[model samples]
Target: MDPAIASKVLPQGLRNRLSASVRLAPDPRVHYPGSDFPAALADAHILISGWGCPALTGDVLAHAPGLRAVMHAAGSVKSLVGEAVWRRGITVSSAADANAAPVVSHTLALITLAVRRTLSMAAGYREGWPAFEARSGADGRTVGIVGASRIGRRVITGLAKADAGYRLLVSDPCLADEDARLLGAERVELADLCRHSDVVSIHAPLLHETSGLFDAALLSLIPDGGALVNTARGPIVDTAALTAECASGRLEAYLDVTDPEPLPADHALLNLPNVLVTPHIAGAQGDEVTRLGRYAVEEVERWVAGRPLLGEVTRQALPRLA
Candidate 1:
C-alpha cells in the first residue's frame, strides 16, 4: 500500500472487518521482508487491496491456490490487478464510485472558483492590497464537461445546487442525447464544448483513443482566461502542451494529477501563477476509506450468499479503463 495512505487512512474497524472475513496474514511488514512476499501467497483466499497493494502477477498467483477474488477498496484497479488475474477467472470489484466523490467535489469547487477568479484575487490580495472589483459570478456561467463518467455526472448534480444561472455542455461518444439531458447537460462535440464554455473539466478514462486527447490543437480552442480542470489520469492530456499553455499565463489550470506525477522537486509548474497542482489526491481520503471498506464487505456478503456482485467488472469494459 502507498505508505502515505496506509499510515493515515485505514482505521481499526475496517481492518477488523477484513480480518474477520479471512485467515488474514500477519501485517506484511511485520512478518516478511518485502522481497519474500510471494512465499506466503498460498494462504491468501481473497486479497483486499488498496492504494499500495503489491502487484498481482502470474508468479504471485502460482503460490495462491485458494485465491478467488480481489476486492479493491479504491479506484483504477489497473495498476495492481493485471491480466493474469482476469485470465484465471478471479472476480474483482472496485470502489470507483466511492472514490469519485472527492474528485467531483474538487472539480465543483474549482468550477465556482474559476468563474469568480478566486485564485487570482487571493494571490493579489496576498501580494499587495488590491481594489475590489465587481465581477461575473457562476450565475449563467457555461460549464463544459468532457466526459459523462461517474465523476462528470456527480459534478453536474452538484452544479445544479448552486444558485448561479448555469448552462452545461457535455461530450462523450458513449452517452446518448437523452442521457446527457437526464444529467442536466446538453450534448455537444468536444471541440464545441471547448470553444464555448467559460470553464471545462475533464473526467474521461485514459485509454488508447483518449490518451493525449487534449493535444495542442484541441487545447488551443479553449477561450483565453478560461479555466481547465483535470482530475483524471495525467496522460489523458498532453503534458508538454499543457505546460506551455500554462506557462504563457493566458490560461488557468487546476490539476490534481499530472503526467510523470509528483513533478520534479523544482518543476516550473510549482511556481506558475495560474496553475494549481495537488499531488493526485482527488479520490477518497480520511473517512472515505471506510466507504470503500464497507463496499468490499457488502460484496463479500453478497458473494457468500450466492448473489451477484453489485460492482463486478466485466471483460468488455476492461479495454476502456486506464
Candidate 2:
C-alpha cells in the first residue's frame, strides 16, 4: 500500500473497481495502528495488497473474522505473507506472471548484448575508433539458463524466436526432461551448464538452499570470455567471487541484482570493464505496474464470482519460493 504504488502505479479504473468491492484501509505504510486496523479488518472479506503491505501475522488474522482471500499486486508474496494466512485457509493470488515480463525481456536483451560483447565494443567506440575484430558471434553459441522459473521460461520463448543460432541448456532440479524439451532446451547439471555455455543466465529464486549457489567454484567453472547474467536475487551468486572473476577479465556479467543491493559507489564491480550492473530495475517498470494492478483486480473479481483465481498460490510452493 505504498503511496507511490497506489497513486502512480495503479490505474484509476482499477483503483475504482477495488474501492467498490473492498474496504481499502487508507494508510499507505506497511503497518497500521492496532486500533485503526482491528476495526477495519473485522468485516474485511478480501485484502488487496501491494508493496509495503504489512505482514499478515496470526495476531492480525485473529482480528479479521471474515477474510477469505488476498490479492497481491506485485511479485513475491513471501515478504508479506506468513504461515498464519495459510493456516487459516486464506487463499492468495499474486501478479508474478505479469511482473515476469520485464525481467525476461531484460534477460533476453542482455544475452544478445553479451554474446556480441557490446559493453566492450561500446567502450572502444567512445574512446575513439580503434581497430576491432569480430571475435565472438551469437551464431552457434550456447545459452545456459539456471532455472525454468516463470522468467526463465519466457526468456527461452524469446530466445527461440531470435535469429541467433544458439543452443539452449537448462538446469533446474524440479524441471522435468519433458518440460526442458518442450522449451527446446537440453537439461543439464548446473556445473555442466556453466562449463559448456557461452552465456549463462540465472533465474532461480532466493531460498536457503539457493543462497550463494554460484560461489567461487561454480564461477570459476565459467569458460573464459563467457558471460554470466543474473536477473535473479543477488545472494544467489557470491558477490565477491563475481567481482573477482569480472575483474580478471576472464568473465563478463550483466547483473541487475546483487547481495547487499545498491553496492557502494566505489565498489570494485563499478570499476570492472567486464561488468554491467543495474539497480534491480529488471522487473515491472514504467507502465508495467499497471499490468500487476489490473491482474490483482481481475483476481478479486474472480473470487467474487466464485471462479478460481488464475494466479493462486499453493501452500506447498512457499518453501521453494522464498
Candidate 3:
C-alpha cells in the first residue's frame, strides 16, 4: 500500500478488525515506498500489499528474512511481486474477486448500452428519437467474450441469466469446449467471435501474445454499428484501429481502458461521440473500495487461522492471470 492510500484502504474500522488478529504495522511508510524505499522487514512475517507497493526484488527481500506471505488488498499482483518473492516460497493472495464484482456490473451496463446503440443514438438525438426499424434491443443480440477469465465467465453467467436471451460466444486459447458449454457460451476462434458478435467484450489478460490482439483486421470483422467494450487492460485493444472505426461511425466503443492510457488531450477518440473513453474507473472505487479492504482483512483472518485462502494466487498461475 502507498502511504497516501494506506489509511483509506485500511481505514480505522478495518484496521481495528485486522489488529484483533495480528499486531498492526505502526508505520506503513517503512515498507510502502518507491525508488528510495526503506522497508521495515525485520521481525515482519506477513506483508499486506496494495497499489504502489514497490516490486519485491532480491535486495528488498534480503532485509525481510522472516517474511512469509503477501496478502494483496487490490487486484492484479502481476507487477507487485518478482522472482525474489516466489523464490522465498511466500504464499500470495489477491483481493481480485472483490474487485471483479464491480467490473462485472460495469461491463454488463456497457453491454446493455451497446446493444441499444446508446452512443450513436444519443449523438443523433437532435434529429429525433429513433424510428421503430432503427431502434435496437438487447434480445437476440450476439456478445463475444474475448477471454474466459474470472470476469469474463461472470459476465457470461450474467448474460445467460438475463431476459435479453443473448447468444454468447467465447474465445480463449486456454478454454476447453466442454467448459465453454458449461459456462453457457459457445467456444469459437477469435476471428469468428469478432465476425459474428454484435458486441465484443474484452477480458483477456495483457500478455506478449495478446497485446494488440484486437488489431485492425479483427476489429474490421465486427459488423458495422457494432460496439466494442474493454474494461480489462489497456494494451489488449489496438487504440488507433479502434479510433479509425469509431471515427468512420461504423463502430462504437465503450472503453474504460486504453493503450497509451490517459491519452493525449487531443486524441481523436476523445472527440468522437461514438467512442466513450473513461479513466479506468471500472474497478472498485469510492464506497465500493471498502469491499476490497474487507476482503483483504478476511483473507488475513483465514491465513492467521490456518484456513484455506479463497483468493490465493500461485506463482505457477501468474502467466495466465490478469
Candidate 4:
C-alpha cells in the first residue's frame, strides 16, 4: 500500500494489533513493482494495497513467496489484481462496500434535485422566474436506475423510503423480477426506462458490455427536460452525446465522472447551465475516509479470527462487480 495512506488508515493502535498478530512487514510500505518494493515484498506474508498500487503480476508475486492475503483499502481492485494473484490462491478483499455509502447519498441528493428540475430552473432564473407550469414536483416522478449494483440497490431502497414516492425503474440483465420487486423497483429494459423516466441515475459498472451503454439513441429516449445523474464510472455514457443533449437544453446531467476525466478544461459540458460536471467526488473522502479504515480494520480482525470477510472479493465475482 502507499505509505502515505497506510499511515493514516492503520494508525498506531491498529498497526500494533496487526503487527502483534502476524508477521507484518517491518515497514508497512510497498507500492508498485519499482524502487525498493521487491526487497519489501521478499518476506511479506500479507499485503495491504490501496489506490495507485500497480498490478500484482506474476513477476511481482515471485518476490513474495509467503504472501497469501490482500486487503485493499480502496474501492476497485480491478487495476491492482490480475491472473497471477488468483493462480496463487491469494485471497482478496476490497473496501468498496464501505465506499458505497457516500456515493449513494450523493446520488440520492442529485436525484432530489433532478426531480425538481433544479438545474434548469436555476439556469433559467437569470432569464426570469420559472412559470408555474414549468416547475416540476418530486412526488410520483419516475426514476430510472441503470444497474442493480450495490449502490443502485441502496438508492432504490432510499428512494422507496423517501417522502417523494418516486417510481423506480431498474435495468440490469442480472437483476431478477423478484429481486427488483423486493427492492421496490420495477424491472424494465434500458430503452423503456429512459423513455418514461423523469430522472435517470446510472449505477452500472464499466464492463465491456456496459461500455457506451448509454449512447446517443438511449439518451435521446429520455423525456425532454429530464435529468441524467451518473456517479458510476464514465465511458458508460457517451460524452459527446451528453454534451449535445445538454447543449440543446433538451436534457440535464449531473456527472461526477466523465469519460475523459477532468474533461479537457474547455469542454462545452463545463459551460452548459443544465449540466454539472464534478471531479468524481461521490465516493469516500475527508472525514468519510475513516469509514474505509474502520472497515479494513474489521476485515483484518475477521480474517485473524478465522471468520468470513465482509468485504471479500473472488475471481469469479470480479467481472460483475464495481
lDDT of 2: 0.85
Computed on alpha carbons, the lDDT of every model, listed in order, comes to 0.79, 0.85, 0.90, 0.88
Residue 177's lDDT in candidate 1: 97
Q: Give the distance in Å from residue 93's predicted Cα in candidate 2 to where it truly belongs.
A: 0.6
Candidate 4 lDDT (Cα, whole model)? 0.88
Candidate 3, which ten residues in sequence have the lowest lDDT sum?
A: 29-38
Judge candidate 3 against the unseen true structure and give its global Cα lDDT, from 0 to 1: 0.90
lDDT of 2 by residue, 279-299 (tens): 999989867788888999899
Q: Model 1: per-residue lDDT, tens digit, 1-322?
A: 5555553344566567655655457754322237555776678777667776778899988988888888777788888777888889988888787677878888888888888766666666767876655355777788999888878888887886665788999999999999889888899999999999888899888888998999999989998878789988888888889888889876788889898787887887788878889998787768666787678767776766679987777667866654
Candidate 1 displacement at residue 280 in angstroms: 1.2
Q: Output candidate 3 Cα RMSD.
A: 1.5
Tens digit per residue, CA lDDT, model 3, 121-199:
9998878877889999888899999999999999999999886879999999989999999999999999999999999
Minimum summed lDDT over a 10-residue window in model 1 is located at 27-36
Candidate whose lDDT is highest: 3
| Model 4 Cα lDDT, one tens digit per residue, 1-322 | 6655666666677767666567666656545545676567788767777766778889888988988888888899999899999999998999999999999999999999999989889988999978899988987899999999999999999999986878899999999999999999999999999999999999998999989988999999999989999999999999999999999999999999999988998999999989988999999876576677767777777888899999999999999887
RMSD list, candidates in order: 2.5, 2.4, 1.5, 1.5
TM-score: the better of candidates 1 and 4: 4
Question: Residue 322 error for model 2, in Å?
Answer: 5.9
**Candidates, ranked, TM-score:** 3, 4, 2, 1
Stronger candidate by lDDT (1 vs 3): 3
